[model samples]
Structures are given as C-alpha cells and as structure tokens.
Target: MTGTPEQVPAAEFGPPEDDIARLWTPHRMVYIGGQDKPADDTPAQCPFCRIPAGDDESGLVVARGRACYALLNLYPYNGGHLMVLPYRHVSDYPDLTDAETSELAAMTQTAMRVLRAVYAPAGFNLGMNQGEAAGAGIAAHLHQHVVPRWTGDANFLPVVGRTKALPELLADTRARLAAAWPDA
Candidate 1:
C-alpha cells in the first residue's frame, strides 16, 4: 500500500465487497457534499429565513406562528421529522426575544401533538444542536428538531449502511401534518 499514485494498483483503492447488500443512495451525495448549505451566516444566506417567503405547501411549512414556524426537515431523519424555528434570524437560544422563545416552545409542543395525531409515533426526540461543535448542520440560525420515533425506526440501515430508509415522501408527510395541525 506504500506506493506512488501511479504505482498503486486500482484494487488497493477500495476493499473487496462482502455478502452484505448495497443500498445505493446517490441522491444523498448532494447533502453530504453540502451543496445547498449557506456560505455565510447572514439572513440572506439562511434557508430558514428564506423558507417563509414562499407559500406553506411549497416550502413544506406545517404550521406558522406569530414569531415562529414549523416546517418539515428537507433531510429528515424520519418520516415526520420536522423543525421549529423563530422568524427572526438568531443563532443562539439565549438571543431569542421573549415572544420568539414563547412561540418557539409552543410550536415545538404543537409539532409533537400534531405528529402524534398524524403518525402515532411510539416516541419522539426533541432538541436543538447549538453549534457546529454540537453537530448543528446550519448553526447560524437556531432551529429545534422534532423527530418522531417508532420501535424499530433505527434499524441496521442507518447503523451499518449509514443511510435512513424513510417510508413516506416529504411532501405527503407535510400535507398530513399541515392538515392535522390544530387551528390557531
């Protein structure tokens, strides 16, 4: 294995295949490459800020609050995975205004309720990734993740294959959640 690029055989680049089945998810390459990630922390570069500018269905917005909103995650961890974010561009949780904080928490609760009504998940994971060091994909704008979980949701696919198998489309999931969202 200690040879120059030209001298090394092509066989050495990749290991031989095993008996495991392959799940080709080439579409995930774009997200893995950060193709749509914002280059800067400005509001103009923030997807959360831009999403509200369009209509609800097109943006996958499930519900809208006065100071915050709920929308489906473009790259969801599960079928009903969604996010709650404040309208105003803010990075840190402490930076949120009182109204934004209130609405954000309220929307988060509503998201869980709606998911229960729509998907009837066995459990849920709710949290916010504070910064890049904490595993935040887009740390510039703070958003709380609301992930619904079933008993066997985390199967070998995500663990061994490093991919998730979502059973439903985002658009369809969005419509269901939007419809199930209680009137404000």
Candidate 2:
C-alpha cells in the first residue's frame, strides 16, 4: 500500500489551500505519503533535522531548542500555522520523558506568545491530536497545534468547500514571527 511521491505542488490553484485538508480522511492519498497506506508516498524525515543542514527558512519550523522544537504546519488551520514537536518523535504524551514534557509545554507557551504578537489573535485553539481517533495526522509522532482564533475565524469557506482562508503569506508570517521571537 506504499508508494513514492510525485512532487506535484499542492498550490497549483488560484487561492491558497487548506493544510487541514491533508488530515481529512478522503484526501489521505494526497497527504499521507505512500509509505503508510499508498503505493509510494514521501518518506518521513525528521523535519527538525533540516534546520542545521539547510532549508532553515522553509517555514516548516518556527523555533528549536535542545530538547524539542516547534514546526509550522506548512498547511495550517489559521494564518499562524505551528506545531510543537518533541525531537524524540514519540506520539503519546505520557510516553514522553518528564523533561521532554516540560520542554514541550514551555515551547508551546512560547509559540502562543509569538502567535499573539504576530497575528494579534483574540484566542487560540491549542490542542494535541493524540491518535487516529483523536485526529493525529502523524499518528506516530506527537505534536500540538497552536491555532489563532478571532471572534468568528470560522467562516463559510471551510463549512461549504472544506477550505480555510489564510490571509498572510507563509513567508511574511514566518519573518514577522521570527523577528518577534524571544520578545514575543
């Protein structure tokens, strides 16, 4: 059921696409690289590993620490798409060592601060998709999403076409947040 990736850009359309769509069950073929369930999907690589090697500004990452890291969703539910990831790549929260748990929380908190400053959101939808039943897109890797929400961030777009509208460009958001870090 595994396959290789064809490198087709998901952004071949006019407007920006929704990252959450990858988690939707019907689009698993496009999201879950073939290794998991299809004939050939992109292999899973530790995204954090790319920072030191290169691709630092790819927007897939917000920040990194000694114990854990925060990566952008590339596809996000909100303008500020981000995920708190532990370097170890374990999925279950309880399975994380006490130190990793502590670091993850601190990183998550920092991410919230950064989002608030850059996006100026009224609130956030912070959560962990524990597993398949809980909506873990990467069921094997534990991660948390920090999504900014205003009074009515949810609009007719997602409800009707399963699409989400992100205003700021990914590069712009990344630069703004990166500059606002530590102080953010």
Candidate 3:
C-alpha cells in the first residue's frame, strides 16, 4: 500500500520542527548582504553622508541639526535604537569642528530624551564604536549609538541564538520618535 505524492503527509518530506520559535526578520538581509556598506573610507562612499541627501522619512531621520542628525538604526539592537552622526562624514571624533561637536552632543542628548518620552526605557546605552577594532560597522563614518534598554531586555534568544527579537518595526519606531521629538 504505497501512498501517492498528495496522499503522503506534508510533514513527512520536511524537517521536524523544534520547540524554538522562529522570528523571521527578512529586512535584516540588507545588513547581512552588506548592501548599504560604504565601499571605502571616503565621504563619496559613505552611507552617513548619503543618507542626509534623501528625504527625512525615507532615510529614517528622526531629527536634523545644523551639523548632525538623528536617524533610526536600520538594524536596531532594540526598539527605538537611534544614532546621532555628523553630516561631514568624518571618521574621528576629534576631526569635527567645534560647531559640529556641539551639535552632535546636543543631538545625542535629544535622541535620549525622545527615546525616553516615547519608549520610557529603564536605562540606556549611549556610546560610539570608534574604529573597526572597536566594533564599528561602518568604521569610516563616526556615529554615536543611542540604545534604549529595558529591564530583562537581554533575553536568551540573543545570548543563545545570537538573534534579537525586536517587537516594533523600524519605520513605526521612527515615526513614533519623530513625532515625540522636541522643537529645535
């Protein structure tokens, strides 16, 4: 009594399912594929320099300053994760002019305030990954990360599976942050 292709259970041909639930983040493929990475250290090849040229919403820019801007992390560590970067595309923090430095600091503070207003995170991790050795994804562009951290936010998934489970969409989070942003 051989079963026909249709008669056989569909499960028989597929791998067995495990207890771990899968969180399909297809959008991460852009990062995984390295599509948006700068080709070189020059401003001409930098994403940070290019992003400001586009529209705010499309670029995920939450707020703009004279010398720096705040934008959503396309690949966020958590919900409401954002970055404040200078528009000049300089790699080193010391390279920024006094005006750029002042604005970058202000922008970072504003990002934290906005994140707190919208997400009400218990804590935050705000810093810059300076160079490639320091784990900077785009070492050519200096950017400060503003990550909102909630209690118990670091779950087993990230530790065990090396995957983060973000509850909100990037666009949605960007909109919320942009709306909550204060007037310049």
**Which candidate's lDDT is highest?**
1
Using all chains and alpha carbons, the TM-scores for the candidates as numbered come to: 0.90, 0.72, 0.87
Instruction: State the TM-score for model 1.
Output: 0.90
lDDT of 3 by residue, 1-184 (tens): 2599799877786545778676666777898898878888998988889899999889999998888999998888988889999988788989999999999899888888888888899999999989999999999989999999999989887787677988887888888999999888
Q: For each candidate, how many residue pairs have backbone atoms clashing (under 3 Å)?
A: 0, 10, 0
Q: Which TM-score value belongs to model 3?
A: 0.87
- In the range 1-184, model 2's lDDT, one tens digit per residue, is 1233456454453345555333233433355463433222222454433343455477356677777877677667888878887877576899999989998899889999888877788998889988778887666677888888888777776776666767777788777777777832
Instruction: Quantify all predictions' global Cα lDDT against the true fold.
Output: 0.92, 0.70, 0.88
- Alpha-carbon runs more than 4 Å astray in model 3: 1-16
Global lDDT for candidate 1?
Answer: 0.92
lDDT of 1 at 3: 79
Candidate 1 clash figure, as a count: 0
What are the runs in model 1 whose C-alpha is more than 4 Å off?
Answer: 1-19
Ranked candidates (TM-score, high to low): 1, 3, 2
